[model samples]
Target: MDAYWSPLCTACEGLESGSVLVTPVSERPFEIEATRDDRIVVKFRDSGEERPLHREQFSVLVDRLEGSPITLETLAPGVEPYAAVLSLGPEFVSDGEALSLALDEAVGGESPHLLTPEEARTRPERVHDDAVLLADLLDRVDADDPSSLDTGTLTDLYVLLSDVQRGADRVRGTARNSLLERLGPDQQLHGRFGTVRRTTRERRYSKDDEIIFDALDEHDVPREWVLGVDPEKLDVVLAVTDLDEDDVYDVDEQVYVQKTGVDEGEKFSRLQGLAERLEEVEGGEAIQEDLLEIERRIDEALASG
Candidate 1:
């Protein structure tokens, strides 16, 4: 039987927005049959087994369309009049004409408009939806005061968080366009651009609470663990943890050890000495047996010492 389509599938309304696209997970091919209320009905192509999943739950099955892959180098105002500049790959350099054309295509207007920190701060309306606000709310939630919000406020908080994120994305796209105009003709940009993972889901992060967001990690830290943090501090903490947006992890409260290849204590230094000795040996041929012995000792130290 053909999967029925329902006009009432409000859950799939984003299908019309072009922001969300659904595709089967590589392992299982599923056809989206219909959406109703907050649920999406999907039928597995192979098994013909149909199921209804909450829209929020089903969203993880698909991907959202983010903007262009072009990277932008964020610059300090002292270094450049613009907030950022186009960062083409090391091998590719854009001529002035190419940069101008790309900039025109990106913003459809004059050269990039740079925002000074003072200007940016004065015009709060421009960057209205910011992560700073979300961080503030989490702070309040952690305080456990009588005026603390009810449990239902979390939904509202998430909605606002999404709005802020979308606003930031729109701003970033414009910044990228502006930065493209700043690139000098044939200017080379070295270093690989970092990638960020974005998602519709939000997870709580706390610095004082000792939570680190890692890929493939999940945590169920209690609400009490949510810590208050200023935006700058939060940025620093995230940089240290290296957790970007869109990381989803299972919520586990247990601590686990991460292994580094080097052995602990004096053995690692001794291994270095052994390596230097091998390098000094004639073609490193005579010390091959000695090197092997040292490596064996280092491995034993790493494993048991």
Candidate 2:
């Protein structure tokens, strides 16, 4: 299977240039050199050869990923995916490659499934019921510290929510387009589920910055008050004036944690089962080995939590 990339990945992460992209089948890698306004430049890792793709080629890719995570070969007869890989951002590029590779494999007909009538009928209902249960779980957690949750359980919730969110976005996007077809400009449709209104949103912006600034000047508006300080310009000012930064700006720095990886759910499930079994034991004491293993798992869970 070949890894693929899409501009849609940008919607998930903030992307910039110099991201690494690898070809799965060839085991060849490319480095993103620059992401300019009009085009993207990717350099071959070994050859030092650069390939530039125009922005229009990327537009074709933006919407393709949600339907099919594809490489250039499968995307179209002639297309781009390495170029699109830039969208995955530096942080998630490796993750995107593995994910897109799996998707590309499935798109190529690996372990494909055709749902049974029973499955087709019951699957959505089962999801809805599970959603209801999850909502109840969250409602209870909301009043308490969610941090009190075991890391494995928190990870499970994260995975579940991610899947549900993706499914919802896909379903709602399609339905929204379908509903749009039946409505007119400025028309409103009120239904039991929700009310939707279609209208043109107009925004006004200045095309000529100098002229706009002059107009503001004529209107007695201070240009500095009208516009924000450019950080680069502010840097020059600070250097020349030796101004105290604390007087000009309020500094705020925050500490946070982020997920780096996930362990297999099956392993966590088995650990949970073992813990439950220990809780249900007839005697006050359990085997030293079993208790030690459970304690180890608990320590690991908290370390990541």
Candidate 3:
């Protein structure tokens, strides 16, 4: 019948490192700290002995509350740990109090479920699902505006995806769909929401010719050109020459394609057009540029051409 009884008060034990200690007294939480001697200490406001309590007593105290909320606090220095006061709803208040007292009086018993730092860090499958979802979202956004993506937005998306990949599963599907919708083309064969895809075709020219033609095709004027040693190895390369004269001069591969260029913009518009035509293409396989490989191939073609 005592309002405050230490007999039923159970001490929650955590690792010698700072950990939350749930007590039965008024739902107040406490932290477990380690003494210099390596003994665990739980600091509580209610006056009693400051000695370490056995693990059994702690388990009993926690079990009595069931799912009730308790308040957690740190009484002494060096015992600062994250503690929460779990509030027991009205229905469980009396029962929770009784269990708390009983636990204080209980002798030795098994400890309640407590997670170590390592255990708490275990990666769940849900985390991976979140990652996949995030990646999909990034792809979608990239499809819409590759240059528009800033590091901050990418970081935010990465964090969300990482969280989902870590544990949040429900958001995965939504993230994935959002991404696909962003990447797909609109009815006009232009990307939805101002997004565009670029296309490029390469041709070969031996000298100052009237019109550069696809040496590979021998017929059509290629939208772009690649210089190579032989027709078979005519890899795609970007060529920029003085508009006044037809002198073909080698330029830095990176400089050839400006980030913002009329030619590049037109090429992306053309790609969007092609995408609309290939709507029926199945299995996700199509002519895709390996951006890195594309650059390498272009460089090789320029060096050889």
Q: Whose TM-score is greatest here?
A: 2
How well is each residue in 242-299 modelled by candidate 1, as lDDT tens digits? 7873363344578854322322223323334555766896878654554345434432
lDDT of 2 by residue, 15-118 (tens): 32233454544534565566665566767656888887666666555445545555433333124334335335322222323323233322331111112222
TM-score: the better of candidates 2 and 3 = 2
Candidate 2 Cα deviation (angstroms), residue 200: 5.4
Query: What's the true lDDT of residue 236 in model 2?
Result: 80
Q: Any runs in candidate 1 off by more than 4 Å, and if so which?
A: 1-126, 129-132, 142-150, 184-305
Q: Candidate 1 — which pairs collide?
A: 9-35, 217-249, 217-250, 218-249, 218-250, 218-251, 219-251
How many pairs collide in each candidate, listed in order? 7, 0, 30
TM-score of each: 0.19, 0.34, 0.18
lDDT of each: 0.37, 0.49, 0.37
- Top lDDT hit: 2
lDDT of 3 by residue, 1-305 (tens): 12222322223222433333444333333444433232235465344335564434434445644554342232223211211211111121222223222233332222222333322222433343233334444445763564577875655454543354334433434644665555544322343223233333699756544434434457664545654555232322312332422233454545432222123233334434544544655632342332223333432332233
What lDDT does model 2 reach? 0.49
> Which sequence of candidate numbers ranks them by lDDT, best first?
2, 1, 3
Q: Any runs in candidate 2 off by more than 4 Å, and if so which?
A: 1-148, 190-192, 199-206, 214-228, 235-244, 253-305
